[model samples]
Target: MNGASLATGQRSLGDPSVTFPLWPPQLRGCPETSTAEIAYPVEVDYAYEDVDTALFAQAPGPDLARWAPLLPPLHAPTLGEGGTPLLELDGLPGVYLKDESRNPTWSHKDRLNRVTVSAAVGAGAPGVVVASSGNHGASAAAYAARAGLPAIVLASAEAPPAVQSFVRAYGAKVLTMPAEDRWPLMRRIKVLTMPAEDRWPLMRRIVDRFGYHPVSNLTVTHTGHPFGAEGYKTIAYELFAQLGRVPAAVFTPTGYAEMLYGVWKGFAELRRLGVAETAPPMYACEPAVGAPHARALATGTPAAIVELGPTGAYGIACTVGGHRGVRAVRDSGGEAVPVTDDELRAAQELLARQGLWQELSGAAGLAGYRRLGREFDGPVVCVGTSSGFKDLETGRERVRLLEDVDVDVSLDDLLRATDA
Candidate 1:
């Protein structure tokens, strides 16, 4: 593999005093700090150089590893995860959709898993572990399989049947359990586990003993995976190349807002390198049930945990907000908009009418844009995060069979029956 110009170390978001090496992926909570709830987001430094602006016009390949200069060393195999299409709606002028459902796993999580599972391979771990509601597990399992590693998926019993089946089909050992029980067992097993609350300390222990790499949050508040978000940066690169410039705004369906942060970072990098004059504003759209990012922005905190109520947009219903998300919103002068399930459903139907079948949660960005009811100075992009097939409602329709036509029916009779 061609080596990346990865810098020596990383700095913490909560405290600059807490720094660590880029290798052996660091935790989200700072050990030197007293408050574990304060998310310590680590940033990987790279030796970025100014490249020719004309290079942006080149088409990006399906594999994100082709952009290795901007990413960490990757060891996992690719399944054509990136290079999703940017499409425009017929009726919605100055609005484009970044169709993430075109990915291998039919979700944006494929980008994250591509990099995170590679961390497991880089660490020489025997297997990978993840605690997910649905899509994350399915993507992680597929990537782990591609890396020739065993995958253990600890998913919520409430996860959709289709998502569960996807994980199992990827040859990952799946355990359906309550959300609270997933982390403890994963840490004990010393596998590379996903982010969760009440498990950071134990994860630190497992990392120390078994050298298991973690690619998700480790703090009470979400800080996000350092390298995993790098995969999402490709979306911005593709958009910039496709649009010939940055759009005025980008609306994303937000959970922990990893993709939101990563997209913003990519645009910022382009501006820094003189590829673009400015970065677009980022809008984070979340289910109104929780919306921790909205709460944090309103309360003016780096991170916040909010009590969640039930909502149909489960994919974006995160209880905690990440500091990276807050930074992205603030730096870009953007807003976090809370959307209702009703609005998301309407957006889903609208997209479906346009021949784009997206998950309800994946349509949150469109819902937010409609809720805003304002026009942008330039083109706006809404990221459709996943396929409609991943939603639980996908296969629930009942098909009614018409009475069978007689084999001996004449052509006139068939025509008469059709006319009737």
Candidate 2:
């Protein structure tokens, strides 16, 4: 009946204060309790009603302004990652394409970095660093610049030049390093930069203390600010709002599985708040070369930390599992499907027919959907996570709009001859 209660759209059982950590602890495996108490720097007051609205809104949960102040003003990018058109594929039962190439950074990674940079700003770091093969680096750099924060992206020299160019364009410092050096450096950065206690106060005063902000490495799954994943929740929220119901399944291309975790968590929150009747089963589509999620799923484990193999779909290429990946698969009752490069290329062609352009890894969801579409009932949405331009260093073949031809004579000569 009160104003705050009306906005929340729920009655509070009681007002309670609780301690929260700087970051949500990663879900290792199936636990006795469905939710884990996360640790943030400060204590927050929570009510049943607060969780209710956060669950159902057409956005991800958590307040980014509170959690990540170093970010630029949060606004919807016009390119449209959040409200993607869910189109039904012809002859594919209940299959839908959730195209993400339209995003500002031309990838779904934009959603994650937007949240991650906010956290970096909140943490009072001088700059953020990341180890990325491509899309993640581009997005991280883009958001870092927007927040007026410095960024350093470590990438392999062998990576596509176009990807490298994107990082530079955003004015992020690019560090070309070997794969062995990337993770070790990232871990060191997190330890040195993050405050041991009182993370909220440090984060809150980021802008005020320093006119120019800097954030540390963004590659850490656990270290990333909570608000980063919140951006991805918007995907699910919009899907639910637009469709007027939850889909039967959602298939995503998994690297660290952050995107998958956000969507799954969003739906779970909705279901918990009585907004959604059920949660969709989440399916992860990874390259066959390094299918960590698939291996973990096969063993019924939360994640399989293994060495990564070589692959062209470098964006979703990672050896170990993040906390989100484990939780996403287990909580959704979903599985990971390994897809080959050939299969992804074919999916890309399929999307091209529908006028949706996507990168190779982005096509993995479509590949999985093609294989699993028969089993799923009702609606099935597969996310295309990036644009082809990110990997153009190999050089995509040019498409000719016209063929070479010659005219026998000029217009005046033809007219004179015809008249005569």
Best by lDDT: 1
How do the residues 211-319 of candidate 1 rate in per-residue lDDT, one tens digit apiece? 5555555567886666777788889999998888899999999999999999998899889878899999999999999999999999998888999998988788888
lDDT of 2 by residue, 331-395 (tens): 78998888888888899888888788788888989898776645766788898898878754356
TM-score of 2: 0.72
With candidate 1 superimposed using the best TM-score fit, by how many Å does residue 164's alpha carbon deviate from the native? 0.8
Regions of model 2 farther than 4 Å from truth? 1-20, 23-48, 51-81, 178-227, 392-404, 408-420
Give the CA lDDT, 0 to 100, for residue 238 in model 1.
92
Which structure among the candidates has the greatest TM-score? 1
